[model samples]
Target: MARVEELLGDELLEAIRGRAAGYDEANSFCHEDLAELQAAGYLKMFVPAEWGGSGYRLQDASRAQLRLATAAPATALAVNMHLVWTGVARVLQARGDQSLEFVLREAGQGEIFGFGVSEAGNDQMLLDSRTVAAPQEGGGYSFTGTKVFTSLSPAWTRLGVFGRDDTGAGPQLVWAFINRQAPGYTIKDDWDTLGMRASQSCTTVLEGVAADPDRVFRKLPVGPNPDALIFGIFATFEVLLASVYAGIGQRAVELAVDAAQRRMSLKTGRSYAQDPDIRRHVAGAALAMDGLYPQLESIARDVDDLADHGSFWFAKLAGVKIRATETARQVVELALRTAGGSAYFRGSELERLYRDVLAGLYHPSDDESAHATIATAWLGPPED
Candidate 1:
């Protein structure tokens, strides 16, 4: 697989560039394209082995994410969320007796999942969500909440939601693997965005929906100990976001290099590629991306290792997530600066890349809250 990337990098890049214009115009990915991805079995890597997924290591997953992101940001973004949810489900399946057999079977069969963690009220109340899950008469629980920015809203067959229990154990999660044809669920059909427009991250609402007892697994708060299963979900998201930004950076450089070869500045009577300043800027952007790539992978590897070991280090994980997100933002910004004017014009691939890349910084990586946690750890008197 590694050798494949090296051999076909240029071809893959070209295809991504070819689709970039149409993808931007549509402002969302085509279902046919996503269905093709599912058919290729690329979506099954992070799923549990029992479910027919490869269940690769974090390193492999991150690498795959980067490769895909480099080609098509929208596909990468949508698929990454599904991968994270799979990891979350895998952990619950492993630690607890609750069988994810049905959903896992579907996932292995190439069904996609939409995430349901980012609710409008729960965004702030996630740690203490009022979205409670009350026990049904016989089994399962009824769930009600307003979730927003549901990535892959139109494409998924399941939803993994986080909420607190009436028991007051921090937060609990439930997987509502609803058949999309089911009632009591609605897609807002409103995902207009300045960038990453193809993500189609619409708002989703679930009212009076009952999750099967077999489908829902509880992630109760166990004091300071990290919820390894849940942490992987957030950490996976952060890692993928970083990979997307890194890809955008590389794509920017590729665009600039292509432009330089074609268009010449009348003033200097030299191709933009021949300009020393343009060359230097592109080089710098490459260097930044190169430096950050391994760093991002390292963080993801640590998160995965921690999850596997059932360990917790809140501050450290937060720091890693924040660092990767912030670095991705810087990398993409520098890429845009390197590309200059051609990147700013309408219908320019570079401009779209810039917009998609900028979305990374603004996404809820919890930088501020993570920084506070890091400071709290540092300022606390030495632990015994």
Candidate 2:
């Protein structure tokens, strides 16, 4: 497997990093960054070599995302959406299910996949849906609902969307992909936010958007089930998302150390690095991060190796994402303090990271959902 540095490269990273703040300040999408990443074949990291890709695994891709986010969180995050789909296909295909092999093949051919699963006010993500999937002729389903936070909105060639189908015996969740040229949908330009602005994750309104028969993928029951496709999506999304924020935490630690080493104590005639209080603060953050890194790695490795956590899988995936994101937020706070007042400025990298890390709170499997999942696994479902 090719290492992330080799694919992303130092020069490419510096250029992308240089453009990050401009994208944020202008509240624009990272078009240049996306073009560069595509040119570098970053999208094909998980596709097999036979399909013109690097043939890497989840662990490798997670590390790549970490490194990418350290340089540019918003850019990395926007790109993360695409990687999630590819990674999901990789996960499912590796386990002997080729239902999504076309995803890999197309991604290998340079097509970008946008994630369109998220729906506003629908917390039972993946397990249920609010988007309506009305059955169409020839086994197709026309999805009609709004998809929020549609990352890679400006560049996706195929969008992976899901909805609920009532025509079935019971409510069945339908997962499908629609082409960007599909007529009935509209991509709204409404992504201005506190941070991660470069992502340009706009809202996509599906007015009976058409998902052709062949493009429609999984159609499982309305609630949780032991489907491999669901597992692939859940595992890939949690692990990769964790990697991005974990990168933020790791970078924050570095910045904290750098700020401490340079900050002078007016009364003591020494750097803050020599101050016990500052040292302890930084060390505490570092300890949290040290634990986080391995947790992320172990989970990614497990997904790659297909380690059977069985019922514990959801708990572990949820736990790692919760830990990586929450830890990153705390670490960024320490970095800001160490960087001293200057970091409060809008253009400061630490300031950017501080805002970027906040998005982690909104990702799927939120605290309530994640805790509920973990509790149910350990304590069994609560009595009716």
Candidate 3:
């Protein structure tokens, strides 16, 4: 924690926060923030130390991400995409799988990775893909499809994409990494949105983009199964996403506290903080956050320690994400109420947080998916 604080000091966070509003207003990518983070080697935090990285464990990385999100949620969210790949590699390495070693090497070499697995209306999550993976003569595949919400689109050098490879006897899912310089790929600057504008998660159009055999990492059955790659992706993505939202909730509570302490009530002729109602609101937010912090940390620690949860791991990961996100949403709402009408302004941090929190609802393992997963885990899969 001290190392993380030293790396991302107050001066740097102030600088990042100073530029956050401007970037969000313009709906632009946080290029300067990214450059600063890259210079500090923050981008390679998960890469193994032997590969010239900090090699922090999953728990430490989650803490670092939480702190980063407190200053700039959009920047932290964009960086999450890059961390996801490196974290996946680390997860596999811990499991004695060297399949994603190249990811660590490339990330240490300053190559940013982005996730391109999401597709519009494809709510099956990783279970299926709308993209077509046309097999080539020498074992490579050309993908033709569009991937949505591709954060770090403008900056990533490598993108992890998946598509259906039906050339075999049965329909197989192909997961691979594709170079950004590859032909037939276009990054659209169509990221105008309600919030988290600095993320610049634009739509990526792939028209026969080629991924060499070396980059094609996994070929697994379509539906949910016990694949290490799948587990790594699910565990890392959900936990980190939860961490980001939890930070937002933390910041909201702090803001509410500050507002309450400073606000004056003419009727009572005293500070709002002295009022029971204001204190109760702040306490409620604090209690909600208190419950979330332990869960987020415990789950992340379990991943780092490689605690055996067997088939229950998926449910645990999904539960953490769902809980953290919903809790953050509730906390932010309370903060806005505590802050009064001032928080309703367009440029207000609380307003931005309110909109940013909405994004969590749309991420993987959403409420619907999470509930179903938990139910299935507790009471077997539903009969056909």
Which of 1 and 2 is the better model by TM-score? 2
Please report how far candidate 2 places residue 297 from its true position, in Å: 0.8
lDDT, each prediction = 0.65, 0.93, 0.92
Task: Note each model's CA RMSD in angstroms.
Answer: 3.9, 0.9, 1.1
Candidate 2 residue-pair clash tally = 0
RMSD after Cα superposition, model 3: 1.1
Per-residue alpha-carbon lDDT of candidate 1 for residues 10-107, written as tens digits (9 for 90 to 100): 65545654676687787766465566556556677766666677666566777777777777787678777787766555544555634454656678
Model 3: per-residue Cα lDDT over 77-193, one tens digit each: 999999999999999999999999999999999999999999999988898999999998798999999999999988999999999988889888999999988998899989998
Error of 2 at 84 (Å): 1.0
Candidate 1's displacement at residue 277, Å, is 3.2
Task: Give the Å shift of residue 110 in candidate 3.
Answer: 0.3
Task: Report the Cα lDDT for residue 62, model 1.
Answer: 74
